[model samples]
Target: MKIFLAQQNYHIGNFESNTEKICCAIDLAKKDGADLIVFSELSVCGYPPRDFLEFNDFINKCNEAIDIIRKHADTIGVIVGAPDRNTVKEGKDLFNAAYFLYNKEIKGIAHKTCLPTYDVFDEYRYFEPAYHWNVIEFKGKKLAITICEDIWNLGDNPLYRICPMDKLMEQQPDLMINISASPFDYTHEQDRKAIIKANVVKYKLPMFYCNGVGSQTEIVFDGASLVFDKNANLCGQLPMFQSKLEGFVLNDDGSIDGPIITQAKDVPDTDLNPIGLDEHLNIADIHDALVMGIKDYFGKMGFSKAILGSSGGIDSAVTLALACTALGSENVRAILMPSQYSTGHSVSDAEQLSKNLNNPYDIVPIKNIYDSFLSELKPIFKDLPFSLAEENIQSRSRGNLLMAIANKFGYILLNTSNKSELATGYGTLYGDMAGGIGVLGDCYKMQVYALAAYINRDKEIIPTNIITKAPSAELRPGQKDADSLPDYAILDKILYQYIERRQGPNEIKAQGFDAALVDRVLKMVNLNEYKRNQFCPIIRVSPKAFGVGRRVPIVGKYLS
Candidate 1:
């Protein structure tokens, strides 16, 4: 038996583009004369569509994509994943499902028995569990097909409890197929291989595991497809986070041999360019992911474009640059909202940076907005002493403008906050926090600067002025970020240990930090959970991104 695996990289919510990529894979599989081809989970609309699935139009668009692939079902058989609606009375509205597609028909829906609800996953919030596990006899072979989390049968988690593998093996299926969106941690692939080995050995069957690649806001699926034989030995393996095709031939006894990796090449070591949050090793793959995230975020959310306040600082510069790269240059609007405290170099830097990035931007000069807010508040606190409230007002005013323009033109507002600033309470809630989505909320300020240098490694896209200029909010005269917070160098180091490493105050203090400094920093991080909870969606790059994965109670008294 000749089976082909499509390790595709899907862009979140970019159904039209993803469909074309899927079609290309199908054609390749057909040319190779493979009887069947398998794709990753949610290959139709991309995995973890998040709030996009909440929209009827987005779901309908995904259905449209499936129908498009269905037209060519006669030449190439496909096992694909998508959100399946249960036409039931008292069940969930959706189900994570896999479809056996051939001859322009959906043979059956293999519902996911395991719906993960831990950490970044919230499957229980949207899907109902499929109780039945049945074998599909296709092309002279009985097959067991499963969705992403179905293969991960451990833990007594809230979503589901049963492991169907033991029960499924009783039927003695010829082969098994798993469609997945399993993400990449440094150690994730090894664990997955162990799982596949154990399952194949247990069932004494040939199995194919196909997973998605590419980044969705805060989540990047690493496509590491694998094949295992009855002996628990890996017959073939596909590398992670790339678009590739693998073919495996089965012997008469259902024994599988080495995979012939096709339509892909080893990544050249010479190329290490700057890519976005969900970036892959390849340039095209990284570009595609960013474009899809931006396109889908806007398209799925009912917007055609977006607006961001670009301060010429690294954070805003990166945000604007990504928006321009994602949406077309004309679609992203940049406002250089300069207040009276804004430096001339900051203005020049923003304009130059905008021109270099080719984003459609303008100088709105928030001096007017800044003046109006202060004027209105002056009468209320006539005798009050000036404090952080005044600084926050400037930030709030700029945020208000960006939001108003977005509301008026149906543009999604983009937050320019970086992880360093967000780690502490440097962000002004209801001010700089007004964005619909935050592009770099998980990336530390230093890393943002590194990514900036990487993007400009070959060519200087980000000007030196923006990169070297003393980082500032410019909410007050002679204001620098260090005026209120520690230097980004020290702050990001502390944050990496505290947030990513999950180190407590004592543990961090053991690394030679002063007791007072450690306590103060940890207190800030702990106290800011409420603010982080209120923050917008942050892209997931690290293992502990600020999105769904790192959940903390707002009322918790757990001080590190």
Candidate 2:
């Protein structure tokens, strides 16, 4: 049996263009003399339809696409992951399913058994799980087919068993096929490969994984398809971040002939094995994912040029590095604004970093602007305390400067604030938050440091001082991030369990840490909802991002 893999890109809701891509892959697979070609999950309708799922017309259009695809049923056998209406009551109204079409017939349709509800996914809110147990007989072999999350039963919590890979194994299938739209998560591929290899070793069956590739908002799906023999050795690999079709031939004697997506990247440890990759840890993979993510996001969204504030800080430096890589150095521009409190080193660093990136930059000092505002407001405030207003004034000035540049040049402002600061209300709303899109909003403070290091893996681009120095907004004199919050190593750990895992103070404290610090951090997180809410577009990488996933009332009381 010859299996074909179509690792391709798709637009979120452009059904016509996306359908054409799928049909082209089908034709290519037939040209290669393959038995059946499998596409990434939801290839027909795109991986995440988001709010489009609510529209009845959206579902109807998806159905219409399936009908359009059925025209080629006689030409070749095709496996397509698509969304369908749920017939059963008392559950979700839609089903995430796959259809096996061949010989002018819809042979077998397998509904996804597992629906992920965490992080960027809320499948339970839109999709119902397939309750039926099925194993299709194809080419004298029984085959079990599943979707992305169907095989992702491994998690921090192991008590709950969701996937029925074990159940499918009972039917004695010679091969298992899993189609996934799993997004990139620093070290997710290693965990994924291990599970697939384990299944191959345990079941004594050949396993195939076909995943999607593309960038939607901040989520990137790298289609690194794999085929593992019964001995658990990888037999085939596909392109990681682009569209390509590959074929593998399995003879009756079990001799496999093919090429896998080459294990070509110089970054170490991409093989499917167990490894931990949290924020600031998996820099190489994160760099690649972000580069692909930024490039595709700009290309797909119809934007060409980007404008960003050059704050001489590590966050802005890292964001600029990625932006330069994504949008060409010519298309990305940096603006430097020095306020009354702005240090000379900051302005100098901004110039040096832009020089390192080889991108053009403009300077617009905010001294006149800051002095003008203070001169006018000094009398009104009288002897009142100059609280956050003074700090925020500096930020708003910079935001205004960047926004003005964006407006004048018709460039989109790329926000550079990280998740740690955004999570703690350390950012000033409409100051740094005023932007068209956020590049590293989903990444944490510690993660930004890692990305900077990764960019300098070959040679130094970000200044060493930027990496080694303590973080600060520089609105106040000699203020370090530690003056307001804990160290990032401790801070990120607490935030991971709190935001992504949704553990409260009691839950986090139970995990063994300083209860006093936990209370303080929780208070800060809860109090800062308004600032995050007012933020611009936040590109999400983690499961729980600020925009929609972590919603808290701006006027809510203290939880503790």
Candidate 3:
């Protein structure tokens, strides 16, 4: 049997476009003489339709799309994911399901059993777990199909009690096929490959996995789909961060008729951890993910141009370089906002960066604007000492100038605040934090430096001075980040333990972190939840990003 995997980029709520893409792939697969073609989960209405799943009209549109797609499934078998209505009326109103279409009719349906509700997944909120399990038989091949999280229950300490593949084994299936819309993190590619290999080894059945590729807001789905032989040897794998349709020949002897694309390796024994500040670790993948995130965010939202305040700091330099790469250099504009405290080298460094990338830029000094705001507030505050108020005025003045230019030129402002600053509440609200999207919010300061190195790997894109200069906001005279916050080398580790690992203050301190420093960092993180809660949507590259995934209270007093 010949099978084709379609790793596609889907737009949420765009039924016409999604259906058109699906039908086009089906046509191509048929022309290539494929017996079965598979698409990722929720390919109909797009993955994580979120609250849009509640509307009856949304589900109706999804059903309408399925009807249109089934008409093209006459010659080849089609497997796609969508929400199926639950007439049983016992649990949730819908079941996340995979539809098997053959002979231009609904051949069979396999509902997803595991509804993941942790870290960026809220499937249990809108979907009901499958009450029954069965394998879909097509062309004399008994195919056991499951959704993304269904096969993830293979480890010793599994999240779900029932494994869908184990139940389907009752009928003695010949092959396994799983559809997924899994999001990308640095470590997820290896983790996904290991789990699929484990499932193949356990069931002794050749498995084919298809995953979606695209960025839906903060989440990025990397479509590196895989196919493994019955012996758990990886026969073929699709490319990452790309939309591809690849075909493979599966023989009746439980062997895939193709050279091994990669050798299966032992799975890592630890949970996904960002061990310290290793800059070179998975830096290339992170770079690609951020570029894709920027490209998709602008493309899907009908945005063509991007604008950002290009401070000479590492954060903004990396953001500007990435923006230029994603949305051609011509479309990305850089506004160099220099204040009274800004050094002459800072402006020159930013100018050199734009020149290196060949992107257009302008110099906009905010000293006069800062002075005007202070003039207006001097009457209210007669003799107040110089403090954060004066410093934030400069920062907000730059933000205002950038926004005004962005509004006049139809450009979306990109925020350049890194994760380290956001975690410690070191950023001023509506100042450096104002933008349409946060580029480096999920990346730590060390990670931003690493990205700068990667961007300059081939040629000197970012200036060397920008990479080596002492990091500062330039809000006050000679103000460095170390004035208020601890060193990034020490700070990022503690933040990773508390935020990503969910370690408490005591647990983090026990890892040789200073107890006083741990308490202070945790308090800063807890107290800054309110600030991060109101900030723009951050491009998530980490396991536990600050957006919809990590939920914390604004008024609660845990460590604060």
Candidate 4:
């Protein structure tokens, strides 16, 4: 049978758009003489329709879309994902299910067996896991279908007690197909291939995976839809971060023969399978993922313009360049808000960056604004020395001006605070951290520099001075970041140890770090939970990002 994999972008809660895209893919597959077409998980209502699944009207709309899709399943078979209503009074009121439709009729239904509940997925809250396993008989072939997390429960130390594939294997299925809405991290692409290969090895059958592609808010689905022979050799893979419909001819022996990949456009057929491990490890992949995240966030939210406070620092410069790339250069605006402590080179560097990108900019000097705030608060701080409060006032001044411009012009303020600053409370709250969205909140300071170098790989997109200059907040004179915080080289390592690896101070100190410094850094990260709690939603590129993925208690004891 010739199977077509539809790796398409889906907008949550937009039934019309999602159905239209699905039907278009179906028509293309039928025209290509495809016997069957497969779509990714939750393609009807979009993945992680989070809380939108609660409304009965939402499920009704899904039913309506499924009905429309059923009508189009004439002559060609369709395997699509959608939420089905659970008729029983017990358990959750829904089942995350896949419908097999052929000859304009619903052939069979395969409910998802495993419901992932941790870290960004709360499927168990809405879905009831399947109690029975059965392979669907279609076109003289036994098909074992699974959803995103079903085949994940494998290997020596598996997540679940029972493997879904093990049960399906008992039915002696011909070929396996899994639909997924897997999100992208820099390290996930390779890990994903490894996991799929492991499944192919365990089942000893050919596998086809159709993954959704697009940025769904913070989650980015890199749609490199893949196919593997019975021996786990990768035979076909769709492009990453794109929408494409590709066909593959499956042999009767549960292997693919002469797979062909075709895109939505008029591109000729190609036999290239672009699933190399080297591609995911490249830093450029991180850059592309962040750009796609920013583009889709604005596109999905219906925002056209972006405004940010560019301090001529690497963080803001990178943010502006990325925003310009995502939302056109004409749509990105920069505000250089220099305070009393601002350096001459800082303003010039920022201007050079804006000029290079051809992005519009306005100079908003906040030295006077800082003076006004200081004058107003002089009585309360008459005897106090110039300290953090005064330093943060300058930051707040810049933030206020940028926010005002964003609000007045209907522009979204992009936060430029990097992950290192956020980890150690180096950023000011309600100040530089004020924004509608955080662009680099998950990127470490070193990664920010790497991104700067990558952005300027072909040409000098970011000014050299900005990339080479000492990182600073310019809140006070001679205010290098290292004065208040540890060196980024040391700080990022410690932060990753504690935040990503969940290593305690004692554990990190044993790894050649100073005991005192480890304690201090961990304390800072724990104490600043309240600030992060109030921060904007970040475009996540890391495995353990702040906000939704990493949940910490604001009032919890520090150094625990």
Candidate 5:
């Protein structure tokens, strides 16, 4: 039997567009003479429809789309994911399910058994785990179908108590087909491949996995779908960050009719230590993910132009470069809002960087704006030393000017704050932290430097001076980030331990970080939850991003 895997980009709640894309893939697969075509999880209505799942109209539209898709299944078998109503009425209203349609009929339905609840996943809130399991017979072969997280229950210390594949194995299935909507993290690609291969090894069956692609707000689904032969050898893999449909032939002897791409390899035992400052990060993949994130966020939102403050710092430089790459250079506008403290070289560096990218830019000095604010606030302040208030005034002045220009030009403000600054409350609310979408809120300072280097890999797109210069807010004279925060090399590691690894102060200090500094950093993170809460949606590239993925109470005084 020839099976095709359709890796697609879906827009949440855009039922008409999503259904049309799915049906188009089905038609293309039929043209290729595919016996069955599999789509990623939640393809009908899109993944993590979140509260949309609660609305009866949303589910009805999903069913309506399914009805249309089933008509196409008259000539070829189709397996697609969508939310199914729960008639039992004992549990949740819906079940995340995969429907098998053949000969214009509902052949079988496989409800997802594992609904991931941790970090970035709130599936349990909407979906009820499958209470029963069964294999669907198709073309003289039994197919074991599981949703994204179902096959993830393999290793030690599995999250779910019941394994769906284990129950489906009872029917002695001949092939395993799992649909997924896994998001992109630098470490997840290898981890996903290992998990799928492990499942194929355990079940002793050929497996076809199709994953969703494109960015949904902050989460980026990278569709590097895979196919593993019964012997656990990787037969093929769809491209990452792309929408594709590829076919393969499954012979009766349980071997995929293709050259072995990779022999079955042992899953790496080494853990990706989030606490350590590793330089071997997959920067290329992160680059692609961020670009896709920007493109989709703009494209889906019907936004064409982007505006950002190019401070000549590494963060803004990288953000500008990425925006230029994603949305055309002409569409990204850079505003150089230089204050009194802003160095001359900083302005020149920003100008040169924009020139290199050929993006339009303007020089808007904030010194006059800063003086005006102080003049207005002098009656209230009387005689106080110039402090954080004055410093933030400069930052806020820049933010206001940028916003004003963005409003006038109909441009979305792309935030350039990095994760390290956001983690420790170094950013000012409604000032440097203001944006329509964050471009680097999930990346550490060191990662931002890495991205700068990656962007300059082909040529000097971002000026070397910008990449090598000392980091600063330029709000205060002679101020460096190190004045308020610890060295980023040290601070980022501690923040990673606390934020990503979930390591407490004691645990982080145990890893050789200074105990006092660890406590201080953790306190800043906890105290600044309010600041991050108000921030825009950050393009998530890490495993634990600060948006919906990492939830923390603003008033929680764990370390404060």
Candidate 6:
């Protein structure tokens, strides 16, 4: 039988668009002479609908979309994910379900068994776990179908007590299909491959996996779907960050029949070495993910133009370049607000960088604005020295000008604060942190430099001076970031341990970090939860980002 994987981008709660996209794919699969087509988890209403599932009207829209898709399945079998209402008086109101449609009717349904409640997921809040298991008998073969998190419960030390595949294998199915809406992280691609291979090896059956592509607000789905044969060979793999439809002929022996066919090119159907898919996480993937995140964040939100403060630093330069690429040079605008302490090259470098990208920009000198603020506050600050109060005025002045431009014209200010400064609370709130979206908030300062180098890999998109210059906020004369915080090389390691790894003060100090310095940095991160809580939504590319995934109480005193 022929199987087609519909790895497509989906919009959440957009029943009209989602129905149209799925029907188009179904038609394409029928024309390709395929017997079956598979879509990602919740392809009807999009994944992680969050609080939308609480509304019965929203679930009605999902059922309507499924009905639209079900009509087209008369010629070819369609497997798609949607939320189904539970008729029982007990348990949750809904079950994360997958519907199999063929011959203008519902053939089978598989409910997601494992509801992940950890970071970035609250599925248990909405979905009732599946207590029943069954296999669908299609033309000449039995099919074991599962949702996103169902098959994830298989491993040496599984998260769930029961493995759905183990129970399904008892039915002696000829093929296994997994519909997923897995989100993307830099290191997750390899993990995805490993899981698929492990399941195929464990069940000794070929698997067809399909995942959703495109960004859903802060979360991005990289649609690198796969087909693994019974021997654990990767017969077919889809592209990342885009929509793709590919067909495969599965033999009765639980192996793909021919060479893997993709929209771009064909992959040789040779014995797949397990190590072939183990690609190390690199900066290039991170760059592409960020660009996709920015593009989708704007496109999905109905934004056309973007504006940001171009400080001529590595973070701003990289953010500007990526935004230009995603939103077009004509659509992106820069506001260069230089202060009294701004170096001559800072303005010149920003101008030169704008020239390189061919993006429009305006120089709004904040010196006058800074003087106005200080002049008014001079009476109350008579005894205060030239300290953080004076320094913050320059930043806030720049912020005001950027916001005014964003408001007058239709533009969303892009924040350029890197993770290091954000972790330490070194940035002034409502100053550099003022933006509709934070571009590099999840990226570390050193990763910002790496992204700059990647942007200039083929041509000099970011000026060399900006990359080579010493980083600074330029709030005061001879100001440098190192004077306040530790070197980024040293600081990022501690942050990765504390924030990403969840290491405590003493545990981090065990990793060769100074006990005193570790406590100081960790305290700063803990004390600044209020600032982060107010910060705009960040584009997440790392394992742990500052947004909904990493939640900390703003007023609670943990380490502070």
Stretches off by above 4 angstroms in model 3 are 265-277
lDDT of 3 at 142: 96
C-alpha TM-scores of all predictions: 0.77, 0.89, 0.98, 0.95, 0.98, 0.95
Residue lDDT tens for model 3, 1-560: 99999999999999999999999999999999999999999999999999999999999999999999999999999999999999899899999999999999998888999999999999999999999999888999999999999999987799989998989999999999999999999878888887888888789999999999999989999899999989888898899999999999999998889687666554333345555546567899999999999999999999999999988888988999999999999999999989889999999999999999999999988878888888999998679999998988887888888899999999999999999999999998988999999999999898898999999999999999998888998888898999999999899989988887898898888899999999999999999999999999998888889998989999998999
- Please report, as a residue range, the 10-residue window in candidate 2 with the lowest summed lDDT: 266-275
Query: Candidate 4 on 1-560: residue-level lDDT in tens?
Result: 99999999999999999999999999999999999999999999999898999999999999999999999999999999999888875799999999898888888888898898766778898899987788989889899999989988876677777678889889999999999999887877766677787788777888899999999878888898899878777789898888899999998876678743322122222222222212224578788888898999899899999999989999999999999999999999999988879999999999999999999999989878889998999999998989999998888888888888888999999999999889888888999999988889988888888888889989999999998888988888898988989988888888888876777788888888999899889999988888999999988877779988787889997584
Candidate 6 stretches with Cα past 4 Å from truth are: 259-280
Global lDDT of each candidate: 0.77, 0.80, 0.92, 0.87, 0.91, 0.87
Off by over 4 Å in 4: 259-281, 558-560
lDDT score, residue 553, model 3? 94
- Residues forming the 10-long window of minimal summed lDDT in candidate 5: 266-275
Q: What is the C-alpha RMSD of each candidate to the true structure, in Å?
A: 6.0, 3.8, 1.2, 4.6, 1.2, 3.7
**Model 5 root mean square deviation, Cα atoms:** 1.2
Error at 474, model 5, angstroms: 0.9
Clash pairs detected, candidate 6: none
- For candidate 1, the 10 contiguous residues with the lowest summed lDDT are 262-271
User: How do the residues 418-449 of candidate 6 rate in per-residue lDDT, one tens digit apiece?
Assistant: 88888889898988889988889988888888
Where model 1 places Cα greater than 4 Å from the true spot, the runs are 6-32, 42-76, 82-95, 101-109, 125-135, 140-142, 154-163, 166-175, 183-207, 213-292, 407-410, 501-503, 510-513
Error of 5 at 107 (Å): 1.2
Q: How good is model 1 by TM-score?
A: 0.77
Higher-ranked by TM-score: 1 or 3? 3
lDDT of 2 by residue, 1-560 (tens): 88888888898888998889888888877887878888889989897887788899998888788777777656677888888788778588888989888876778889887787766777878888888868888778677898887776644554235557777877877788898898876656676677776566567777788999988876788888888765566778776777778888765544466553333222222243222226555567677777888888888889899989897899999999999998999899999887767778888988999998899999998888877888899999777876778888888988888888888888988989898898888888888887777788888887888788789989989988778777888877877889989998999888888877777789889888799999988888888888888887676565567885566788888663
Pairs in clash, predicted candidate 4:
none
